[model samples]
Target chain A: MSHATRRNILKTGIFFACCGVPHTRAALAWSMSADPLPVKQVADGVFAFAGAPAMMTRQNEGEICNVGFIIGDDSVAVIDSGGSVVEGKALIGAIRAKTDRPVRYLINTHMHPDHLFGNAAFKSSGATVVGHHNLPRALESRGTYYLQSYREAMGDDLMADIRIVPPTKLITDEEDLDIGNRKLTLRAWKAAHTDNDLSVFDHKTGVLFTGDLCFIDHLPTIDGSLLGWIAQLDILNGIKAKFAVPGHGAVPSPWPQALEAERRYFDVLASDIRRAIADGVPMTNAVKSAAQRERANWKLFDEYNQRNAIAAFAELEWE
Target chain B: MFATIQLRNPLVAVVLFAFFGSAISSSAWAQNADSPESTTWSSLKGDVFGQKFIEPANGIVSIEAPKRAEDAAIVPIDLHFKTDAASGRIKTVTLIVDENPSPVAAVFRFGVDAGVTHLATRLRVNAYSYVRAIAETEDGKLRMTETFVKASGGCSAPAMKNSDEALANLGKMKLRVFSSKSSGMEPMTRATEMQLMIRHPNNSGLQMDQVTRYYIPAHFIQGLIVSQGNRLIMSMEGGISISEDPNFRFEFDAKPGEDVKVEASDTEGKKFQDEWPLASSSL
Candidate 1:
């Protein structure tokens, strides 16, 4: 039978399993309802709600992270809720507007606040939350600090219902979930962007969700190893994806090509640090002068480059 | 007080930059030249060394610290002396975080037991400023070296430890003496390395209590004195820049039967003193 026919049969089977009847249109309609945010249909079944490339602020209402959902024949899977309750609720609405399918899984791309704070909105939906093995520890260690800082930055009103909701299902290396006819692959990465970084790949559409791994226009922050990030990029370059959804910037960007800018930045950072160490330059001087050649190339280089240089210097000096 | 002196002498800026310009970035050097709050070497020399003439520490003393601090609140600084007891004994060494509210970070006065004169510790730098180390020889001659560091928010950063837990073990200390050989080798004729760790919150008054949501009061080690038997080895005047548990690693000559004594006092006037036999093998 054709793929569409098989999906139809599976949907019919699920409907019968839920309602004990062959044709229950009202029951299906009751399962899903809400106004979801406008999303771009990147692939056959993948929808992306791209966020603006800006820092989280009260005016932005913590909408500085990209989120989306994937639809399978029998169920749907949501990827990364937004930064706050308002964004999460809006995402839920967007999901409802698009499909009446029950969201079987809520996958958090990483432990960052902008990506995972909207987890509470999906709690009542009973979607099994999933993340990397280290996500729970990362959240536990930094959750309170992040909450206090975000509250100060976004104001109490915007942060009212936001609480750290850790992932219940941990992916240590790689795992595949069959939403229906489609299979979504999740892979946990080494200490790169953070200790708990994970990416999702849709087999049918070849759309890879690279959470904070690939930054297009937005300058990347270095909370993890600079060298480790560069190494991961090499592996990411080999992945065959029709389109890639980045953690920041416009989603569904062309794969492999979108990895250039970020890779170049890391390369420059590592070389500059190595040279500085060889020259017996102290961290103070290196922080100001290292990677200065890349200043004009990336946005927000001034704000984060120095901090990155400091971290790199400490690591490279010992080596 | 020296801020007024700098206004009168513009040449002091030129001279000060000439000394530190090669070690620090031009922008930082210019910032020091332009900043009215920036203390010139001569000004600090007069204030710290008084009438004593301070010599350049090109080969005599070297300081190892990050030019840009990874963590501004805890910047590790190592002071190494090239000259030994045969050349000229290191009598005293003073550490200064130039831009901190209390610029006088610490003062180490060595006695006869002073051996190798290699000292290392950590401190907080409140702003982008120079970290200067001045060492005095037994003959009353002073030598100085300074490195410009780029960091800020050190004085106000929160303590990493939980307040209640920190308070529970407050004033506790640990001492470790490095042995020349792992096993049966006899004690060396020269000085040996030793590290002292004190358990104190060293609350910077900037950290908020996570539970109470209130600023913890500033209570840190104000004075630390290390002695061998009746002879004084070194003393330190500490500030919030010292990490949660203040640590000091230095070198001293080990006299077989002499006892190593430590006396520390915090800002709240609580004093802690302990003694250990120098011959103890285990740390």
Candidate 2:
């Protein structure tokens, strides 16, 4: 066995001993992860962390996508749900511990599992699940099948327990919600990540939540349009925000720097796709080459290396 | 010092357990080895995806698929059998990714003599799961071999474009045939290697429509069929997990001058039709 195995067994032995009660332990210790997702205090009332127990999004740095929490005067709005119900409840619990005020708003950045699967957990507290209008359709059509699949893979204990309902509030182009002193401007960015990618900006804090549109340390996963996503990122870059909470990864200190990483990654992907088209390469070959080239040249390249490459190629070459 | 072996912090144990669990189940079914795990995974549990698998006593035909796929979402699956074209030994190829949410991906039945060895096609993989190919041979043995694939998070990815765009081009398809090396008959023999790119939203409908205040209605490709110059070669009916603007690669018997026509339609009024002209140079 490798050294990693030795250390893991030792660690489990310790954890198992501590909780040595006669009762049965649910699932893996994944429920009680020692280290919570690393976070950045982007603003006074907002905190950001990459989505986790390490969900390998085909985008972003070696990080678990992005999950954010923005506290307002009357209540709190969670930006993007976690990869699983377990993670979502954990986030909810953390928020509850910090303040007794019920989480009144649950805003999903997009519909990807990493960002939206946990929405079901927040619904019980009567926090309205909010997203673009197409969100519910996306869920209903492909939702049940995946739901059952997860029930099988993750042992159904977590999924079977929660009630996953569609979003209560649907925003079109832009919607304004009043959190008392704080005005949260929710803008519907069209056809970017999915048909329903939404961006949340707080005028008071100058904090913008650019959902999946912005990936700081990782490459972007393109399930939408190649050109459209890049354009959306450019538009986001133009927006004025003091601290930008991207869909995943660290929130860069200066908003522009964080935006730059996203813009740069998209640029690399587009140019690679353009070049592949120009070279008359097949989509699969082009996808593989682009991924391999980036893996060799880019930093933190291994994280999203394969998924980014194929998803981008498939989206662009489809036409 | 206390005597003990430190297995350290590693995901190896978890992965090993998963692999062991799946491998045993799949192998036991193929060999009828009396292993308990196989009995559970290959229960032929439902009508949609699972089909009863009974090995041939005469050993006339066989099927092969990956032992383990790299991704569960998009698994590369193929079916090969033995016989002559005159017997009409092959009728239809039924594909079942048993562990997928819906299980049944496609069912292809042939009309004219597709021969004993007509390779089949490819289908969407919803997750890391099991794939079973049930070929109705000329005689009648439901031979099946299954392999476990490790893939996840396919259904959650958004549609490839705006709902309008994906909907606008629904029912469109592109057929392409290419060869890695310059070879004859071998390329033609690999008709099962054809690629069909269809245009459809395959909307999981979980996506938010940025423009409308309410959720858009769910729409996706429901039925797909492929024919070689008026011969019914394949038929498929599936839900949205088929992937947005889905592309399906498959195989069927074709001569150098054969004109292959394809037609596909979804539940929400989207339809696609295309006639592919087979050329010697194209392969």
Candidate 3:
């Protein structure tokens, strides 16, 4: 093992001992009889489990990441997992209720906690976990922090079974997974929502899983590069798909058009920040006025817009 | 006999006061809606500066901090000092975050040759507090200015950089001096402006370790001393309010080729020292 991986393992060991929580492997197994998660059949053989459109809270149990599963003639290919072990178990139950076939692959579209924390629920299912090549590094750096924050935000009862589960198979550029009779195309993009963002395309159903990349109603968070995200949107718009499933908000949004609102928000943010920099406006003033034009268009504008502006200014100021 | 009678009549006094006192307090609260429950600047000045006389700085000393911080952990604050109205030289500047765990964030002492002071640095404001800047003149007169910042949880916010990555390059220091006269096209002039940055995590005790899931012990730069040829220019006592990589920018009068020395110590009692030769010109 690499030295960093070894160190991370040691840290994980220490973390488990310190928190007094059981290792993920010792947790409960995935059962077909568990309560099934509610899902909508967005297309033939494609099921989407839409989560609450609000921020994570104790009431929602961090179930704010949309998850889906693509069933083929013989097996199932699970898209992004839910936010918690309960949600993951519910997803497994939902899959079992629809098809008795074994899960062939578990794909994580990104390394965000809301999309990957539920991987522990499918650990016993004998399905290989897959994600972008940078996902493991991102997880190693941020997993512990996210876990603690969620525990404090949602409490121990709600976050009890959640664990940072890294993917076993890494996708660098693109890969196609064959699940019996279906082929799922997975593409990993440049630093956008995060450095490890990925998307999945179901060839049979023409449904695209744009995890956290396409937000319908929610204000897009700028954790990665603003410029990179805008560039990725250009590429995402060109993909041919009948419907798109976003990481958050409503599923099965019309392709290409679903990306407009988010694209506009990012475009305005970049332009405004560039103008602020050119005008020699200070960071404090830029935070308030950079993205004021889009204030009425997005939810949580007050909470995240200033932060986005600040991040953009910091990045663009040096350029 | 009089004490006993007074004690016995306590119930009558309580009955009479309750009817009149409660009504007056409610009306007083309604009138002061804008000013919240926190202690006012006048009281904070007394508590922090003690009996020291403070004169209002009529735009002589100004503080620029975000009215509403984007990131509470790293709120950039700029302090400018113009010697136009001052009777004497600027000696010391103290930064105070009135509501932080440790209100006295830093105290900066300047040498006689320190030119028109313009300082820009980052601070971590723990709560919604008035960030006050107090400057003491060479004649022992003090002038103060303050700005109300709306931010919270800065001290507890996790460090943006990973702990291991931060620790790997601990104590690495960088010094860049910018001279106003050297606009790249102009000839060399007396270089005065300097920006010194020290690499330290400055972890607050509030942030939990992402891996171990425990409060990462607070380890920050506790003391910083800057000197020019053994002459003490400035020294700062920092707390959680200082950002991870403690950075300071100010203008001081120093001759070209003079060695600018810096020494800092962290909470763990480790000492780091670095020295840079001031460049005569920017070209």
Better of 1 and 2 by DockQ: 2
lDDT at B108, model 1 = 78
Q: Write model 2 residue lDDT over B1-283, tens digit each, in one string.
A: 0011111233533433353345334322222111114443445544533465556323334444433332233334545565554333666556666544455666666655444243433345543445666666665545555555444343332234455776676676777664534355575564534667776767544444535765655576777777777677666666644556666554456666677788878776757788988776565
lDDT of 1 by residue, A21-117 (tens): 3323433353332223456678888988778666576666567778999999999999999887767766776566566789899999887788988
Q: Model 3's lDDT to the true fold?
A: 0.71
> What CAPRI class is candidate 2?
incorrect
* Residue-level error in angstroms, candidate 3, position B29: 27
**Could you tell me the lDDT of residue A38 within candidate 2?**
34
CA-only RMSD, every prediction: 14.4, 9.0, 13.8
Instruction: Give the interface RMSD of each candidate.
Output: 13.2, 9.8, 16.1
Best by lDDT: 3
- In order, the TM-score of chain B in each prediction is 0.75, 0.64, 0.76
Identify the leading candidate in terms of TM-score: 2
- How do the predictions measure up, each by TM-score? 0.57, 0.69, 0.62
Cα lDDT over the full model 1: 0.70
Runs in model 1 deviating more than 4 A are A1-35, B1-283
- lDDT of each candidate versus the true structure: 0.70, 0.58, 0.71
Per-model tally of clashing residue pairs: 8, 44, 0
